[model samples]
Target: MWPASRIPFQGRGGADFVEFSQVQDPSMSHKVQPLSSLDDLRAVLRALPGPDDTARAAVIAREPTLTKPPRSLGRLEDLALWLAGWQGRHPPTMKTPRAHVFAGNHGVALWGVSAYPPEVTVQMVKNFQNGGAAINQLCIASGVALEVTPIELERPTRPFHQDAAMDEDEVIAAFNAGFTEPLDGVDCLCPGEMGIANTTSAAALSMALYGGPAETWTGPGTGVAGHALDTKIRVVAEGVALHAGAATDSLDLLRRLGGRELAAMAGSVVAARLARVPVVLDGFICCAAAACLKAFAPDALDHCVLGHVSREPGHQALVAKLGFEPLVRMDMALGEASGSTLAVPILRAACQCHAGMATFAEAGVTDRV
Candidate 1:
């Protein structure tokens, strides 16, 4: 019951890009059971599905037979095994990879938390619709479909420094919006975000979840430096302190400190796990959203990997905290899934090499003594 249409975009030199229609629907899709309260979501999280060990064993057996020496491909071999295990099939394919970018506004942007204004969120979303953003070209090159979901761009969340970013009901609604995103036929999912001052929300969420100093997580988002950066750090500290006692759990912390887009990202991660799709998580804010799941369940993020390490100062530390090694590190900080999209081709290559290579017996190459 996804409400959007799929539009075929013609890229340069006859390349085809699958672009998902950017229509917002508030109702839950019939494909996913609707959540009535936080308890429903908590129950679902507690009972998450795990990877297929059978498929993983198949990869392990086939890898040694390949024409190359053991571990010659390094992480590529690991990536292929991960894909097979999560997809529940040997010789896993990336035939229908997709990226979802969630956009929302933040009330803290009004307090100079970011260099960009909240209105920029709407404008950038429009740019995404028009296929003008960097993510569009990256998706085209990577041959991945693109979907943009704007979560009430006109209604920014309440400033967390002064109060809860979202009430329980509001956060649940946003979480459902992402939880219901259609994953039919998708082999891999790349989740990213686009929102003004969302980095501030991410910083605050991280500080609350990890018990780190606010300065350790806060960084210059949207090119804010000097006093603006100091203000961002102060705001994150105040927001975490205000909500520290009220957050009974990680999900509660997300509701208290996370924006609509962040909550939606968390929901999408859940959706991908339920669908047996491996995920490539984007930069700082996107990873922070996924980290909530890790805090909830120790192995909740077993099927996810960091697509790239952002140039943001806090991202490297967050990645370390999550115990994930990024696939790429280009010093890129532009969100909207730019970093993750760039990784799609790399994953595809990993699968291709694992599936396409012949065994030494077939290749008539003598096995090592």
Candidate 2:
């Protein structure tokens, strides 16, 4: 449970304001167990509960009966079924969707891998708190609650090319910070991040896990290009080469090459899965973090949908690697859950069409002969 009054957030669009105090009972009866070690985390990932087949069957049966022509809605129809299956209930609603943005700094920022300085991460987190960031506005427009968590901003991870980004205990602690976030009444989760030079970390992790040249995974994060882009690519390659042999598995690789924000995003996805909540993965960095889970289990991301295809060069490849067709492609590369928050309304519309549409029989429409 979060400490009393840990964070207070004003509601958007005249909604009642809420505070992070005691943990509210989740809509589902499921409870997340505390993770004490990486071994425990591995076991939990392996034992992830499957979606509710009964609810899925119900969606399939009902979808055909809706007045709309068969498959006219394209991905929207699939979205409804996915929601039903993961929510473990028919007539899934997108009420109370929440977006969590985890922020951390990286020592690699000192190497100029990103155009922005490391201080920008802390500044952006403050912007998020003040409801002044792009994500804050997107969440307001989409009716999703936004929470920003800054994980030890004063202590940036050690440069990965020189040493491990985080020790095992530090990784475990960052992971738990995300794992124990109060899910309570959240119907959907959007996990995103804000970290300087994180794209370098993300690219490093992607290349290490997916096996590609550094150039294949690296991009100009924070608008770096030309010689800076070359620097970013080199950093990714060096970090991956240094840690590749020492990392026993995907999580180990994340610990070696990922920032605290990336680790937290990974943990949040797992927590959402355990609670049977669907997730909307944000841009490149967010996907890179969650992609680590897929190395553990093939269907690890079954409940998640790519919110958008980021303009970042590596994100499209990562999306292909994950086998996800994004809900939208707006050339967006902004982190902080802006893409995923924008996607919430689409899910809401899908659920509304699924649950609110009248059946052909009720509408007195003739069935096709």
Question: Would you estimate the TM-scores of all the predictions?
Answer: 0.94, 0.94
lDDT of 1 by residue, 297-355 (tens): 88889999889999897888899899999999999998888888899888999999999
Q: Residue-wise lDDT of candidate 2 within 254-275, one digit each (tens)?
A: 8999998898899999999888
> Cα miss at 125, model 2 (Å)?
1.1
Candidate 1 TM-score to native:
0.94
lDDT score, candidate 2: 0.86
